[model samples]
Target chain A: MKFLHTSDWHLGRQFHNVSLLDDQKVVLNQITAYLQDNKVDAVVIAGDIYDRSVPPTAAIELMNQFVETVCGELGVPIILIPGNHDGAERLGFASKQMKGAGLHILSNFADMVTPVIISSDIGPVAFYGMPYNDPELVRHHFKQSVSSHDDAHKLLCDEIKTHFNAEHKNVLISHCFVDGAIESESERPLSIGGSDRVSHEHFVDFDYVALGHLHQPQKKGEEYIRYSGSLMKYSFSEQHQKKGMTLVEFDEQGFRSATHIDLVAPHQMRIIEGELDTIIEQGKTDPNNEDYLLVRLMDKHAILNPMDKLRAVYPNVLHLEKPGMLIGMEQEMASAKLARSETDMFRDFFLEAQNSELSEEQDKAISDIIKQLSQQ
Target chain B: MKFLHTSDWHLGRQFHNVSLLDDQKVVLNQITAYLQDNKVDAVVIAGDIYDRSVPPTAAIELMNQFVETVCGELGVPIILIPGNHDGAERLGFASKQMKGAGLHILSNFADMVTPVIISSDIGPVAFYGMPYNDPELVRHHFKQSVSSHDDAHKLLCDEIKTHFNAEHKNVLISHCFVDGAIESESERPLSIGGSDRVSHEHFVDFDYVALGHLHQPQKKGEEYIRYSGSLMKYSFSEQHQKKGMTLVEFDEQGFRSATHIDLVAPHQMRIIEGELDTIIEQGKTDPNNEDYLLVRLMDKHAILNPMDKLRAVYPNVLHLEKPGMLIGMEQEMASAKLARSETDMFRDFFLEAQNSELSEEQDKAISDIIKQLSQQ
Candidate 1:
């Protein structure tokens, strides 16, 4: 059985407050093309189908279009699970009826104990989907003493294992923060610190575990456990990470090989740092000039209308910063805060404002004014 | 072709600030039972499936369940359209894909020109659905001079007539205000006055025009042009209106009989009027005491704690009004305004307050105080 594994589409996501629907459309179209060319039998979307619980209408429409094109137009079965970002009940609506169209959205944990079995050339592949479950809900549902995400996942997985058939290949799809997995700023924290992280040892029994909630495409200790990552770079921290889908091929033997297919983004996210004049000159001749940019100016003096000037050259420049000003301001703020008295702080403010210390006569006048105000 | 026609479901509607989801479930369950017992060929929902463009999550879930029961469980085709309260584009999303499951939702003006042909025992019944189109959108889509909803509907119907087939029975399902149709407060006015009213003559080409937007089950000029009304009473004004679904039986020959199937509401809406004491006394023994009540007190004097007392006997009392207070207050306000000067008004207020004319000593004291206040 051959299947395409992907997750965290975040369809209605905004990059630097700009709507990424158009960009998402371009990348999703690319995935559809790949699906057609590869002739993949099925698709597994681990989770995080939307950027927020109540996504924008445009995002809903875009998702509907994508699902229609993939499952309806291409005739490929799609198994989807709700992520931490989705409103599970809302996304789960009409899911039972949608199964006839080959679009399976698994959201409820109680109904998810049974796997959605699909027949393949070799045998049947049982796809077990686990929607993002809060520890409290999991604990109550299973009547277990699970206090953390790791505990909940372990309990749920163990229960699911009981229903597993030894004769067929079993694939588990879930959205969880696996321990030791690389993190990115774009992915929302499932819990504080690493309490939500589930160790890869829990999933050793499964043939393959397609995971989400980590925006880096990499294997976690084992080749069978992987994160397909986000379809596009969602933050500056993710600029170095390669974004793509993971394709896994399986047979009757239960284990199989997995391959990563890189997706081409319409615009690359780049960080460029230099003096204002030099950066502007570079932008004029740079081959990737149209890429969404975060420019860091190293010049000592503050540049006037910096964003305006940078945008004139790099239209897609999303952010501008002066590292020198940031560092200098941080030091100044610390020293200014260290001033013990209001008078001393005022003196420092005067010196900073006028580029000179307060004169003796001026200080006397300020003291007299303070005395008058205090007397009233 | 026999079909169950219903409209103005307003599934997420609230009555007197109270959610009607539980009540809606009861009525919908009744409809489901009717479908099961009668074994209807199909169901036609004219429009207004949701109370608002963006309905609450529970409403979405209810609508999903209803569709699943009818289309998936019962294996019946359902034709739906968008109402004025609905966001047409959002509701229309995935409509093309939904058709495969026998759930057809027509929302766009451009895409709805062609009829959705369904095979029947007699022959084929061409069902044309016209979603609620604003006058501006209608004019732009067809490039016609439509200033009012009436003009828009006329132009659109004329266009639809061009595609009509004489051999098949043509049924037009639309969410529109037909002229001469009685209305209830629950129905939102499409436009000010009667500008939105489209004459029944426009839909003469169709064998039957199942209409919506008027929350009253009545015919407009002709027997074939009718409004099925809402599934439940959404307002006090609709309490007297019979709420039900319309059952129509048709064939290739065209004109057929239509019957109204009354729905039993979980809680009937009632208006009780009389003196507060008398109303409360009556409520104690009334068989319909549990019904949603709108109390109109006819007491000549002010009654304290009327709502609290009434609620003890009738828990569902939603509104309380003293008609006598309103009349007396309006008369007093008009007379009070006749006192042009502040002093004169104060003098009249004193007379009303004290139930006596001012004495010379009091008048002298009032003048002294007014003079001192004016000086300040």
Candidate 2:
């Protein structure tokens, strides 16, 4: 049985303030082409089809169109799981009804392991989908004293192994930040608060483990365990890495070789340093002319609507910086301890420009927030 | 054709700041009893199943249970129309799929005249469901150079007559507020500012016009046209009126008699007149002991924790109130007016409470709203 393995579409995502929708479209179109040529059995999206938990209508529409094209037009079964970025309950809404149309969406973690068995020529192929599970839920399901991510994940893997039989081919799909994997510097981690991360040991027993939630595409262990990577290079850190999905073919003899396919980023994001006028002129005649460009002006003074002028030639110009970037400004202010209390600083900056002045009671609330931030 | 004509359930209605859910349940149970005894061929609801477009989850669940009991459990075909109170777009959702389960929901104005034909032992009955039409939409639909409520309604009635053959046994269900009909003070009018009022003449052609929207059960022009009223007396104004639904039964010859099935208000809402201290003292031995009750204190001064005290004896007390009820609050502050302006007020109130002063630009925006209000 053959299937196209792809994940982390992140439909409405902005890469460092630049909309990656066009680049994403380019890669998806290539996947569609590949599917048509190869006559694949199924398309598996591990997780994170959207950037936010509550995706915009446009993003939902885009996903609908893609699913319609693959499942409805091409007649391939599409299986999906919800990732950390997705709201599981929302994604899981009416999933049972949607299954009649052959679009399988698994978001419920109530079942320790729910497998969608596909009847193939060789035998029934059990495609197991596990969404990103919270430890509390895992503990409730297992009814044991599991606390941390590692303990819960190990228990989950052990339970999955118990469900497995040697006769049927079993494939595992998951979304978690795996340890000992290469990290893309520009890729933002799923959670800044440590609880979201799960150890890679959970996927050890599966015949073929398809993983997601990491932008950099690479195999976790031998080739059997893999990260299909993001459809497109989302950031400058991923500029050097080849971006695309992995096509996997599995037979009754355990697993077959997986192939990685590369795709060109539709409009490469580039940063150019110069005066505002020169930067705008350079933006107008750049080789990657249609690309979303971020200009960092070396001039001391801020340019008036530099984005507006640059967009006359390059409509996708996302960001403009005068002299120093926001990160640079933060670094400069790093030595100023307390800084008139963090809330007072915010009240003095963003709100002050909007003609906002806090009352004594409001100031107290703001100061409380500052104290919390200081503790963090 | 044996058919039960009921409308305007308003499942989650609050009357004079009191919940009417228990009252609604009592009425529904009565209707269920009537349906079983009468052995009704079909059930027709003329719209407004909920008071608010986005009803509370409990309201939705209750409505679903009612549908299950009537349609699924009792094996009766149910036909529903969208009312002025309902979000037509939301009601129309999954309607296509729901048709297979014998529950028909009509939401669009496009199906204005086409009768939903249902077969029965007598003959074929054409059930025409006309949703409340705004004058602007009616004008747009017919491409007529008319604006008045009378004119738009005349156009709709013409469309109905033109399409419908009076030769067949026909039942018309409508949700509209018309002139020359007595209205309860609590009834929400279909339109506030610009909508034209529909004339009562529209029902002249039909054998029986099952009217909705007006909570008070009343007849106009003859016994043939009637308002089913609400399942319960939804407001203080409706307290004196006998609240229930009307069941219309048609014979082989066509014209038949209509009977009113009285539904007991589940929990009695009594305006107990006395001093607050007297009522509190009387509560010790006052052994009427109904599960749900609404106590009204005659004391001029506001009673602190009145709900808590009243709830101690009457655990199911929906609301507690002072003697003087705010009159015309529903009519004066129309939903559309409140919906648009309430957000602005909330935002301004928040900023002001924070001691945030508005700039000239912000002040101008606020002034513009004040100007609009002054002009109105």
Candidate 3:
């Protein structure tokens, strides 16, 4: 079976107060088109299907439209789990009834016990889903001691291992911050004060482990365990990420190759760093000036509303900063090129401190005090 | 076709800070048992399936069990909508794909145009649904001037009327507060400031108008326009109400009789009034002390730790009150049978105000002041 692996769609997410709805729609269409062109048998979305537990209406509408087209129109089956960002219950509503129709939402501890089995040319492929469950809730439901995310994941995975059928290929889809995975600013911490990580060694028995929660889109210790990353750049800190999904091919023999499929959204998040005038000039000639931008200026002076100036060229500039941002003292520091007299040093220090030069009368008083000190 | 009408399950709801998950499960099982015994063809839940958009896990588990048994197991088709309490977008997720199966959730304005048709012996029964949408969202989606609930409902109903099948029996399932339906305290107002009521005249054309929101389980101006009410008593003010559902029988002849089916939950919310000692004495033999109780004391004295004492008898007593709850002054009023001396009245007032009697010096001062006032 050829499966499209994706996670952290974070639908209804915003980029610096700008709605990513249109951008998300454009990229989702790309994924759908790929599914059609590539003949992908199924789609595996690990988790973080929505940006929030109670997603915005537009987000819900977008998800509704996407599922209707993919699962209903395209005839491709989808297996999804709810991430920490999701309300598991709401996400899994009518999941059992919808399972036969190709949309399988495996959410909750009970879902872990039963796998959603799918047929392939080789025979059958069993997909086990472990949706995100907090430690306290896990303890209550599993009737075991769960003080950390590791305890929660280990206990669930251990029990699931006993239910695995040896005849078929087992694939585990989960939404968790695996130990030693790269972190990103966009991801909300699963636990506030405690550790929110689980070891990947627990899933070594599975043929393939598709993961989410960290938006960097990297692999764990092994090649089979990987994160497909987020749909787009949700934070400026993730400006360098190659936002995309993964494609996994497997058969009766077990896991095969996992290929990376790059998805370029309508707009890219980029950082433009240079002198104010130079960057503005670059923006005028740049074809994709509409990209979401964070500008860093190298100029020394305090430019009057540089954001406004930058925005005039690049309309999507979200933030701006210069070297000496605190007191605007870069210009004064540059002027101090030689060893100076006490009066000159004192004058420069006074101007920098109080934003004003001393009057002639004050200067005379300072000179008199200096002369007295020198004689003594 | 025989239909079981119910709404406002309010799963995961709490009563006076106590979780009613068990109570809700008991009542929902009652509904399911009714479906099995009566052999109803279809189930129509107008709205408020959950107390909150994101319900508790146990509530979700209960609802999941209910739908799985009712729709997946028993093969009874269920039609539900989102009420004011529900997050429409979340509640209606994958509604389109799930429609082919027994469960049909119509939770948006577009659903108003397309009715979920169920087969009957004579012909088809078209069930048009208008889920609760805020007037602002209605204005945005419908692109019309809808500033009130009246406007919102009328516009949707008007649009739905155009698509009604003349060959079939038409039933309109909605979650709106009709103008004259008596409301219960537990029903959250659809709108806070402005009117949250729609005119029942808009729904007159439908053969049977099944509604939710007013938890009284009563009819509008006409008997055909009925509310199935909630699954259980959600508020103390609804103590006198007979909590139940409606049963509608329809065919080619259009609407028939709408019968009220009384559903007795395990616990009934009731108010017990009398002296504390008398009620306690009665509680010794009152087989159903587990019923949620609100005690209204007729005793004149301030009993020490009345709630603790009351809970010993009626273990579920939620509130305690007396006629003179504010001042604890009923005892003084009761002792006013004789014309007491001025000193006695002053002494009593002083004792009540300070919680202590006048000392020798204070009594002498008060007597001297009264003597001077009398002389004046």
Candidate 4:
């Protein structure tokens, strides 16, 4: 069986307050074209289909169009699961009725026990979808002593394993932070104090484990375990990561080869640092000036309306910073000691208040008042 | 052909900060039971299926369950339109694909021109659904001169009339305030300055017009034009309004009798007025004390923690108002003139400052100060 593995679509995500719907549409269209050209059997979206629990109307419409084009128009069976960002109940609405249309969405914990068996040329492939689960809710639902995410996942996976048949090859699809996996700024922390991660060893029995929630495409200790990563670069931290989908070809015999396909994003994210004048000059001639940017200026002097000036050339600049300002601030803190003495402090106060050194007559008047106050 | 007409589900509505999901479930279950018992050919939801454009997770689950039970389980065709509260695009997401499962949702103006034909024992009943359309958007979409909501509805109805066949009996479903229709507090004003209302005469060609947006069940001048009201009492203003579904029986030639079926709500809304003590006494003895309540106290004296006291008996008291406080305020306003005189105002100020009436010594001192000031 050949299947395309993808995850973390985050359809309604905004990049630094800018809507990414158009960019997402471009990439989704690319994926749809790939699906049409390739001889793929099915598609498996691990999790994080939406950026939020309540997506905006435009996001909902985009997702509807994408799903319709992939599963409805392409006639490919797609299996989906809910990630930590999604509200499982909302994502799973009408899921049962939608399965007949080849869009299988598994969000309920009970549904995780039964595998969706799809027939292939070699034999049948049993696909198990485990959605993101809250440890507290899992504990209450199962009446178990699972206190952490790892324990809850293990318990859930063990229960699912019991229903697995040895006759057919099994594939487990999930959305979780696996132990020793790389993290990114965009992926929300599943729990406080880093106790949400589960061990990758739990899925050793499965032929392949397609994971999500880590926006980096890389294999774990085994080649069969991999993170399909996000559909696009959601943060500056993920700028170095190659965004793409993973394809796996397997059958009843067990393991097979997997291929990674890189997706071309509509726009790239870049970080640039230099003196304000130099950066402005560079921005004028830069080939990728339209890319989203985060700039840091090293000039000591303050630049007037820096953002407006930068945006004249780099229209997509999202953030601007001045590292030299912090250095100047530290120096100003050291010079503040001169204002600690009463007379010198008064002189400094006069200079600061008046935005200049006080005149000779004004200084004399201040000294006379100080003398009178001392006498009192 | 026989059909059940309903609207204003407001599935995710909150009353006095309390979730109405359970109450909505009760009413929807009643409607479901009614459909199973009756020989209805189809079901039409005029509009306002949700309280907000982005409904809560529970509301989405409730709506999905309702649609599944009606269309999937009961095998009945259901047609729905979007109301002013709903984001039309979001509500209509996947609607085109959903039609294959006997569920028709019309949200766009273009779709409103076509009718959803349902074959019945008598003949084919053509159901035209017009979702809530902003006057500006309607003007732009049709590229016509429609300034007010009436003009938009008239133009839309005229377009829909062009598609109507003389052979089939037509039913028009819409979500707009009809001219001269009575409204309740629960219904949101469709537009500013009441320009959102449309004339009922626009639907003269249709055999039956199922309208929504007004939470009062009443026929407009014509018996064929009606509003099904909301699924439940969403506010105290609707305390007297009987919430239910309208069942219509008709043929291809003309209209038949329509019946209003009252739905028994899990909790009724009530408003009570009396003295605090009397209200408490009544609350303790009233048979329907558990119902949601708005209490008005007539006691002339202040009551301590009146809401807490009332809740002990009537646990669901949502609001409390003191009518006697207004009368006391008026009396205080009349007496405030005594403080206008300089001597009396000084005395009152002294009394307030000391939290007690002025002493004879203080009064004499104030009089001496006033005499000295006047002479100066």
User: What does candidate 2's lDDT look like per residue over A1-376, in tens digits?
Assistant: 7877888788878766656676677677887888788877788888888877666555665676676677767878888888877766555543443454567787766433677777776677777888877778779976988876667677777877778877888888888777778776644565566655566667766778888888778887667888898777666546567877888888778678799878667776566667767766776677777765666767654456777777887787667666654545565567565456667577777575778777788788878888888799
Q: State which candidate has the highest DockQ.
A: 3
Lowest lDDT 10-mer window, candidate 4 chain A? A337-346
Q: Write the per-residue lDDT of candidate 2 for residues B1-376, one digit (tens) a residue.
A: 7777777888888765656776777678888877777788788887888887655545665676677677767878788887877766555543433555666777666556767777777777787777776778878877997677677767767777777765577777888876778787667777675353567777787778888888778887768788878777665446578877777778787648788778777665555655557766777787755534556666555556877877666566666666533223443456556676643674578587877866667767777877788789
The lDDT-based order of candidates, best leading, equals 4, 3, 1, 2
Over 4 Å off in model 1, which ranges?
A: A327-376, B109-114, B162-167, B328-376
lDDT of 3 by residue, A1-376 (tens): 8788899999988777888999999999999999778887789999999988878888988988889889999988899999989888878878988876789999877887788887887778889999988889989987888999999889988989999898888889999988888999999999865488789999899989989888988999788999999988888888889989999989778888899899888788888888888998888899999999888887767779888889998999977767645335754665564456677778888899989989999888888887788689
Better of 1 and 4 by DockQ: 1
User: How many clashes show up per model?
Assistant: 0, 1, 0, 0
Segments in model 4 whose C-alpha atoms lie over 4 Å from true places: A252-254, A299-309, A324-376, B165-167, B328-376
Task: Calculate the i-RMS of every candidate, to one decimal place.
Answer: 2.1, 5.4, 1.8, 2.0
> For model 2, what is the error of residue B251's alpha carbon versus the real structure, in angstroms, after optimal superposition?
8.2
Q: What is the C-alpha DockQ of each candidate?
A: 0.42, 0.06, 0.42, 0.34
TM-score top scorer:
1
- Candidate 2: chain B TM-score equals 0.76
Better model by lDDT: candidate 1 vs candidate 2: 1
